[model samples]
Target: GQQVMQIPQYQHVQEGEDFTTYCNSSTTLSNIQWYKQRPGGHPVFLIQLVKSGEVKKQKRLTFQFGEAKKNSSLHITATQTTDVGTYFCAGSTGGFKTIFGAGTRLFVKA
Candidate 1:
């Protein structure tokens, strides 16, 4: 069985600050995806990393996959009210099933 886990389940930041969340998997993953879910909203796809040690960025957000393909991370450069959400990392083992980490809840203060 495959499993994905995330740490620091919750984070709080002030405006202009930074935040980060980490995810780990029990088995090597073929690919990993990140998602963001706003309060009272559904999860929205952010990015996907397939290559080992790959890193990608979008505006103030950065995503990374570990060299072993069993870990990943998401970092937000500056905090904002709009950035408040729960972040999730999902890992797939080259199959239809994907294991999702226990989302990290982020709260930003203005």
Candidate 2:
């Protein structure tokens, strides 16, 4: 069985600050996905990384996959109240099921 784990289960930052969350897996993964769940909302897919050491970005957000395919990270630059939510990293070991990490909750203050 494979498992995905995220660090700093929670993060709190003032507006305009930066935040980051790390994810690790128990086994090598074929692909890794990132999702964001806004308060009172469902998880929404943000991005997916399949290549070793892959990196992607969307405006102020950045994502990375480890070369070993067993780890990942997400970083948000310039925090805003609208960015408050839970971020989750999911990994698939070339299987039908994708294991998700305990989401990292982000709290932003003005």
Candidate 3:
């Protein structure tokens, strides 16, 4: 069995402040996918990190995959009210099996 874990189960940041969430897996992953689910909205795919030690960014957001392929992180450079959401990390071991982390709920205060 495999498991994906995420932390800082909840985060609260003032507008313009930075925030981050981390994810870890019990076993090495083939790829890791990040998603954000807004209030009352379904999870929307953000990005996928497939290479070890890979890093990607989308505007104010940055994503990273561990060198071991067993950890990942998502960082927001500046918090905004619209950034409030539950961020989830899904680690795929190969084939069709993917384990999702519990998710980190982010609250951006204005």
Taking all chains together, each candidate's TM-score versus the true structure is: 0.98, 0.98, 0.98
**Across residues 1-110, which tens digit of lDDT does each residue of candidate 1 receive?**
78899987999899899999999999999999999999899999999999999999999999999999999999999888999999999999998998889999998999
Where does the lowest 10-residue lDDT sum fall in candidate 2?
A: 1-10
Compute the lDDT for candidate 1: 0.94
> Per-residue alpha-carbon lDDT of model 2 for 1-110, expressed as tens digits?
67788998999899999999999999999999999999899999999999999999999999999999999999999998999999999999987899999999999999
* lDDT per model vs. reference: 0.94, 0.95, 0.96
Model 2 residue-pair collision total? 0
Clashing residue pairs in candidate 2, if any? Answer: none
Candidate 2: C-alpha RMSD after superposition = 0.6
State the number of backbone clashes in model 1: 0
Best-matching candidate per lDDT: 3
